[model samples]
Target: MVKFRYFPDMKDNNIRNFCIIAHIDHGKSTLADRLLEYTGTLQAFQMKEQILDDMDLERERGITIKSHPIQILYKADHKTTYTLNLIDTPGHVDFSYEVSRSLAACEGALLLVDASQGVEAQTVSNTYLALENDLAIIPVINKVDLPGAQVESVKHQLVDLTGCEEDDIILTSAKTGKGIPELLQAIITRIPPPERDFNKAARALIFDSVFDNYRGAIPYVRVFEGRIEPGQKMKSFATRHVYEITEVGKFLFKKIPTQELKAGDVGYIVAQIKNIRDLKVGDTITTLENEAKSPLKGYKEMKPMVFSGLYPVNSDDYEELRQSIEKLQLNDASLRYEPETSEALGFGFRCGFLGLLHLEIVQERLEREFDQNLITTIPNVEYHVTDRQGNLFIVDTPSKMPDMGDIEMIEEPYVKAEIITPPEFIGNLMTLTQEKRATYVNTHYLDPSKVQLIYEIPLSEIIYDFYDKLKTVSRGYASLDYEFIGYKPSKLVKMDILINNEPVDALSLIIHQDQAYYQGRRLVQKLRSLIPRHLFEVPIQAAIGNKVIARENVKALRKNVTAKCYGGDITRKRKLLEKQKEGKKRMKQVGRVQVPQEAFLAVLQLGDEK
Candidate 1:
């Protein structure tokens, strides 16, 4: 009897799996489009720009929100056929967890650098992530045909950063379809195929998964040591629960059914996983009878750093919003939420996200895809609050914080931020970060022209206008990447906003003592601009416990009650004015200010206080 690693013919033309990594607008998606076109994976008419970015928001924003994996076939020299598995990853920092998950499933990566832009923060950060996974990285310089293409400068940076030879870097213009053949040739020649172990127990790594109403949860997997197919009894390495797989397939844009997904192949398995929670993204799937003892490495649970309250615009849509969020949770594993209510906002869920952009994407997706009208509160980061007598608890929302008198100390999450930009922008970036209370760490030069600055800054600072400020100061020359290091003790307090002497808990926030006054002033100022003039003066005050830090009022729209007494006596005018004042007082006592939708959104714009 003869045994084959993947397939009998696959040994002749091996399979190569790889993904592209770059900063935003660096042309990873364009390069992917060119590859798909060149390989004839799809007909010319069937293709569009960023075809892998399936979401409507991704297409409109020109950014990839998800990591899409697909398999393509390439025929070289009119004889040898090769299987190319390409996992196109997101470029934004908020989706770095998605990038890491995709990288772990692949054996190699194409480290893409934009010719004119050179090395940015995310490019460097992803390179280190690829290195940690021991992926074979091939440096590629893209957009070489652009008018401002400085191919030589970018090549030098790549050589310096990656330490690869100058000639090893492939130059390509994904827009014009130039040097694509050479790039594909390099993939088959330079990047080696996945190693195989046929005789061992079946083991496959689940890198991503999706929920199917009819078929249940299906996991996209990379087989390490075995073959998986329909009718095979498999158990989750993490859950130890057994189920029978009904189907197995590979991605060619769509699910193409295969007889079996063997070792060294990338495909999906339908174990009929009814419970979406059981289908973990990083779990290992193996045969039930002789299962692998150890779970796959490089898998970690992602904690949501940013928290916000998502409330329905209509109180009646609360149930629909909950269902939509639950459905989205099945697709996004990192999303965490629980039932939370506010006295002013009514019923809502306090949802957690990886970052600000992640929160934005989810909110947009829910509104667009699920047809749910939601009002997302300002984003907040998780905090560690230690009360007196050594009791500790997590406060993701300001309302969750204990009384100030009972609390010993509060710790805010801190991240080690890596920022890369032109040497000239270093001073400007330092000023911007300093305003956010960033602590200087160190600096290094990728080359003489590009500088990398490291700092330890509070995660809350970056969650707001830090990115916008960084870009403004640097004039679009800077890039940022950050990771949560740990929590550190800070002089933090819960600041509440009072509208007409009533505390609106939804507008409350936890802030450092030093920034409490400044932030409060900004909040009141923004709310004052957003709220419309009322029948009476409505005071908007920002207070810390009992002390008011800032106050802004929506002035009353003066009505001319005395105008009717145009030719009347002076005493008659005075009596009319007095009666009007008494009526205004009565209205103020019983009237409730109806805050507009934009007013709730004003919390997000408070960071623009500058």
Candidate 2:
């Protein structure tokens, strides 16, 4: 048994750059763990499940939220050594942007499918993304040892997905280590190595970046055209800012400093980048002395599909929150935010996310990593509003919308959604989409048991509780994938939430006129339930401009003033009661209602309960 070793003169032809792409919980991370063990990257004492997943949230949820890059050495035939760089990508739809970024840096991908579950929605979507990137794909059927494994059936589906012959698919149980050696052999033979060109001008693509308090922004790059070394002055092709490289290294679960990085290498370059903003992800880094003529066809900017307001629980911490968000933005290029103030929530940022899950993950990271407590308002989608003045503007928050009297048109983003599920739930799915204002487009049978449903639906509808309900209707067997089609005109109005006649800007929403009443009523009722009773009467009203559509009052707490005058004269008691009533009226005039955080979150689950 020959062990892996680092060879100084490893040829470019011996390098294989690939990524593992699959649906959520189909064992992408598990397979990654096995590969690291087989290649002697980590000893028995150092190995762990999902060793590449660094975040606590990912470990808890058994999911991969971020794309992790790792390098391993594999020795084959007990003689020759090979260098392999593998990027492990997230499988959830919300993190598809992460997958896209990983795909941009690789030359091939392992399209993993579950033998029992067959092909899922994300599997299809990611396979298409890999094809679009012109990546060589090796189809792998994982968990073949399961009792319910449908090896023959899944192989047929992979044939449709990859257009490959049935015998070309590799079957392996990543847990039991079955067919591990065969898969490694297939990778070396099937996937083509990256082309090396050290003679060209040095160019590297910033696929991702991280902020270091000491060194500043450390960019994770893929060397494209030439080689980069320490002490070389490199300038950002996008920003035109120059800096000398301080260090460069690769990660084998941990950063190991290297003297230089050549073409086709994926590693980190530390130039003591201070701002973090200066090293933008997807930007190119080139040598100032001999710069590349053109930048790599980089990744497209990922547009956020959902928008929400994130405010600090304590107003004094606003500045710290801003700083924390900026640092987080360094790691997440898909996360977008801007300074925004709400009359009710005070100063905060209006953040944009790829989806609701992305928003939730960011909030968790902020709270955990920065120790910042945040209040998130109702999630909404960016809308295009044409005012009465004929000016078109984007409104991500309801507070930014003009009054109903402005008399203008509005457009909301729409998505073409694909759902794969068993045909038994067709009726329930139809009803579910109907309630969400989804238009039926087409349906096709993937095989005999699975049916693929396509619908054009508003982006807003799919952001909320839809994924949960989708699973419910299909008995946890449904998978969804969607893409933004374009904006479509809709009759939408801004519904405001008021507490004691003062509008709560954070709780406002832009809803279709037909749904404004019902949704507003549900939201108002939820607020009434979540808010505690105050000394003064608090009226929770959902209104359109001035006219109230739904109202719920939290009755003021009362103290028995008459209890003190047990046997007093009737006139005396009446006088005391009148004085108490007058005092109560004055308190109502000057009093402020302290709404709890739960009230702010009520809008998220307004439609969840009956």
Q: Top TM-score: which candidate number?
A: 1
Pairs that collide in candidate 1 are none
Cα TM-score per model:
0.94, 0.93
How do the residues 1-610 of candidate 1 rate in per-residue lDDT, one tens digit apiece?
2122233357723899999999898999999999999999999898999999988888888898877889988988878889999988888888787788788888899999989899999999999999999999999999898899888888889988889999999999999999999999999998889987766788898877788888888888889886786778988866778899878888889887777887888988877787677877677889865577787786676678899999998989999999999989877777889988988788999998988888888888898889998888878998988888999999888898899989998999999999999999888888888889999999998888799999999998888888898889888888899988999999999999999899988889888899999889988999998888889999999999899999998999889988777695799988988988998899898989988888777767876657
Badly placed stretches (over 4 Å) of model 1 are: 1-8, 557-583
Candidate 1: residue 13 lDDT (0-100): 38
What tens digits encode model 2's per-residue C-alpha lDDT throughout 219-240?
8888978888878888987778
- lDDT (Cα, 0-100) at 50 in candidate 2: 90
Per-residue error at 430 for model 2, in Å? Answer: 1.7
Q: What's the TM for model 1?
A: 0.94
The CA-based lDDT of model 1 is what?
0.87
